[model samples]
Target: MVTLKLLLAISTIKQWHTLQIDINNAFLNGDLNEEVYMSLPKGLTVSLSSCADPPLVCKLHKSIYGLKQSSRQWYTTLSDALLSAGFKQSQADYTLFTKGQDDQFIALLVYVDDIIIAGPNLKLLHQLQHSLHARFKLKALGTLKYFLGFEIARSERGLFISQRQYTINLLEDTGYLGSKPAKTPMDPKLKLDNIQGEPLADPSQYRRLIGRLLYLTLSRPDITYSVHTLSQFMSAPRTTHLQAVHHLLRFLKGSPGQGLLYSSTSSLHLRAFSDSDWAACPLTRRSTTGFCVFIGDCLISWRTKKQPTISKSSAEAEYRALAATASELTWLQYILADLHIHSSTPAFIYCDNLSAVHIANNPTFHERTKHIELDCHFIRDKIKAGSIRLIPVRSSLQLADAFTKALSSTSLNSHISKMTVHDIHRPS
Candidate 1:
């Protein structure tokens, strides 16, 4: 998803043309490296001279859909073909391949059989598509309108990507289409625990619901926190958890068309916000870490997860959150460099905790910080190297605050707006 966002960002910046293609019988194109045999079909018309006494089965020479090794074999074949075409595969993302440099550059992103090709040169892009068609059976999709369930709309302003169809189907499947719309996905005062209610008779249903919701989060950042909270009870879901899921479904019913928008007018500057909810979990008392990264005004990446260990203080928890954010920023830097987009200014990281910022800038370790793991000190090195600078902001202005914990309806909407999440299909 990060690669997809970067590709869109670069395309928007350069006003490049984008195309999509689908491979027909993709798995069957792979040539088998090992000998494998299968039984003959129901009807056999082989000559007696060619058949053994017991009749010999058929040997397979090509890949098949059901074979466990089919995907690997297909990937190997595709990678070899691209490499032979003077395209270099990205070390950070093997699925991404690039050719040429600067304005002449073209990129191809592969997701199994579906591929997205984008570049500044239209003629070269079409020529490469023809080349790929010659090697394999390709179905040309003139423009990249839809891929992997995401409906993409491109205009002079920018690109709008949504999953309205997917969300509608999910709502219909879960029987929430006719339900009342919810103002908020989750109640701020609601508290969920492992043993709060009776165990569900069939936990698989709950698991399935959670799985579908997980995929919806790809484009809908508004439900990220609520979904993350409900996902924790997947192992042993209770009645309360099921109710919470229904509440989320109601929220989706209100605005199923919401999605992410990438503005062409936005700048290319990188900034991030890091935050944590100290001891948010009632069962394990583990802190939840949340961070969101933006390239200019567009939100590219975000995460919400629980801490691996218990923190003695809120500053420690915040510092750990900063470490995670720094790691993501470092990877983003590498990706931007690969895309030939360099930033002269250092990336800025915002946190509401002053102590955490002090800890990152401080050279000497205090007695209270002796037990801190060496891995948590990664942000310090990044700060010293001038790769990223940490700044303290007020808690109310923190965009990641909604990710770490449930917020009031007003606060949630405020953060959502700041993150640039809304329904582009709707009127202003």
Candidate 2:
């Protein structure tokens, strides 16, 4: 359900008209496989001793909404119906179904029982409704104003997808609704280190805090570094680490309405930025790898993870970052090809390290890079094959740097602004 909702949230930015509909009594339509029985309700069988035998149990002939397998059963019923109607399920994404007749096409995306129908056929969409209503109790919701978490709006200029309500609720839940705002999520001067010291009072509370901050990444990438740093101490959190998490909540208080803004544009370029910190972790010498993927100006995917293997040098750490970026770009290219949206422009991968770029373009097997030769060769191969081109982007221009380490308030603001996340305000 979350996956389907996220797709609609993203496609809204493309200015495509949307329609949301829900199946009434969705679970009751499914056929039951076994003879399931439930105890009678409290009102029923008022006098248990009055009955000759035990009180009769209500036998379930069809699936109900609250059953464990109810959703999956209803999904199967819907899939069979769509398949019989000549719609083909997308191999890449199961929730997506497509039907086309020459120039006319219709795409149906389903979130459990709620669905959004889009294509070039309003007439056919109405026809589809008549047929669907006959099979199951369904209501056609007028032009979507809000679907899932995003509050949607469309005008002559473009479409707007925002989660203003969600953000406000987050602030209230974290007790940041009445707190003073911090200029930045974290202070650069404060270096977080795990000394040989005692852990916090309650480890579970620290974990709960980290979990919420992770979800905030949906709209606030600025807090990505602070959250990433605090996650390392989940098993045994210290007082200092908990303090850092609290500071981030204060930051969230300031920008409760922020969310990613995907402007309507027509460019098919796959660009990415790769960055890594060299031996930054105090406990372990492992560096963090971070990258962000963009489709034209749309921010689609980003990741921040600790390197799997320890690198002997900074060059090796940077090389691992490139390979991670390549994997993401490859998946993205495949997804585009499936959608018939091929990029005419070549994809560019921006890396901060000069040695990594040289290792990608150069064939020399230096002894220093021998240990990670196989990993280093992927970039060299991709560069030679023209799948990706490595360009030198100045360190200051690197957005992924925000994910690698804590930065000064000025640098934090700069990178956060570059992300282009807008404040999701209510309609005036």
Candidate 3:
């Protein structure tokens, strides 16, 4: 609650003020665990002979932590309390509850037992909290300093999300804190082939290493591609592959605090960029397709992988990529519909390949597109129905370019600048 108030303070000047609230006796207040019974808590069970019946186990009239249904009962209790107090849950996030009008909105986010309270209208926040406090015990934790692992900092630019401390711990745990730095997470000159190299002496150790690296991807886009490549050889890893994995750890050492930073001033429109490099895999002769989805300014999801089928033409490769991206877009449309946050305009899809864009917008039978799979035709239907509109972007500005293939440092940095990252905090 304090953190949200702080966020409102940064964004709204004095127009918004937050109220800090803590639900007192939150767990104890809930009606709970009718099935639970205990022997008189160690002190009162000694005198059973005086009564007509043997000393009966004390019945639990309320919920306690160990019982299976404790969590459900507690949630139901809290939910009823809030609903009675003029609050309604958000359709998008079940954890979020809201009340009041647009500018005067009061919001509460519940985390298990802890609750965060926020509102631009301070008077409303307090009255709600006061009513709750009158019924239950409550404590106020002034301002949110840290929640859900990400450190909070509200400023002119926006809310900066980073995991500087967490990254540092990862470096230390992997024994890479003192390793020399590398310019990039991946070496552009290297080529990976699955030739079934010498197997690891002990496979469990390699599993542990990859497990840690996967978690690191949360903040490090630079490593995402390289980590993905190395992961393929987990079953039979060679010394060369192990060295490549070490190189990634060294890259982490140089910038242990780097992570994604989601800022406030970002576009809310649903836009996706899809691109594919034709016949990029030397061994398989398969193409690679990469796509990124963004909501407003915040990046929601991204993926890069080799396509299942070999494409005879570049247009074929791009059409396959479009099909993959279209599938993702369709899922997002349904998600938004559930939240009642439908796009005001048709969702925009940006692709650098004119051949693929033409195939999507028009259903004409060019000899090249005839061989494309039946699944690929569905994208054209979506375009004609006005669910997704395809737009042509110049090669240089194509954001999906990074995910499709390796690029020069200058080009790589340019593409990185277009990412959702707002800042990197090194724990200073």
- Compared with the true structure, all predictions reach lDDT values of 0.88, 0.74, 0.69
Query: Which scores higher on lDDT, 1 or 3?
Result: 1
Residue lDDT tens for model 1, 7-47 = 88778867888999998753465533434435456676667
Error at 175, model 3, angstroms: 1.3
Output the worst ten-in-a-row residue range by lDDT, candidate 2: 1-10
Q: What is candidate 2's lDDT per residue for 175-287, written digit by digit as tens?
A: 77899988888887777777644688778888987886777675567777788888888888888888888788888777776766666552457788999999888778898
Question: Which numbered prediction scores highest in lDDT against the true structure?
Answer: 1
Query: How does each model score on TM-score?
Result: 0.93, 0.81, 0.71
Predicted structure 2: lDDT: 0.74
Runs of candidate 3 exceeding 4 Å displacement: 1-101, 104-145, 261-264, 279-286, 305-312, 326-343, 364-378, 420-428
Q: What is the C-alpha RMSD of each candidate to the true structure, in Å?
A: 3.9, 5.3, 6.4
Q: Give the candidate number with the greatest TM-score.
A: 1
List, in order, the clash count of every candidate structure: 0, 0, 9
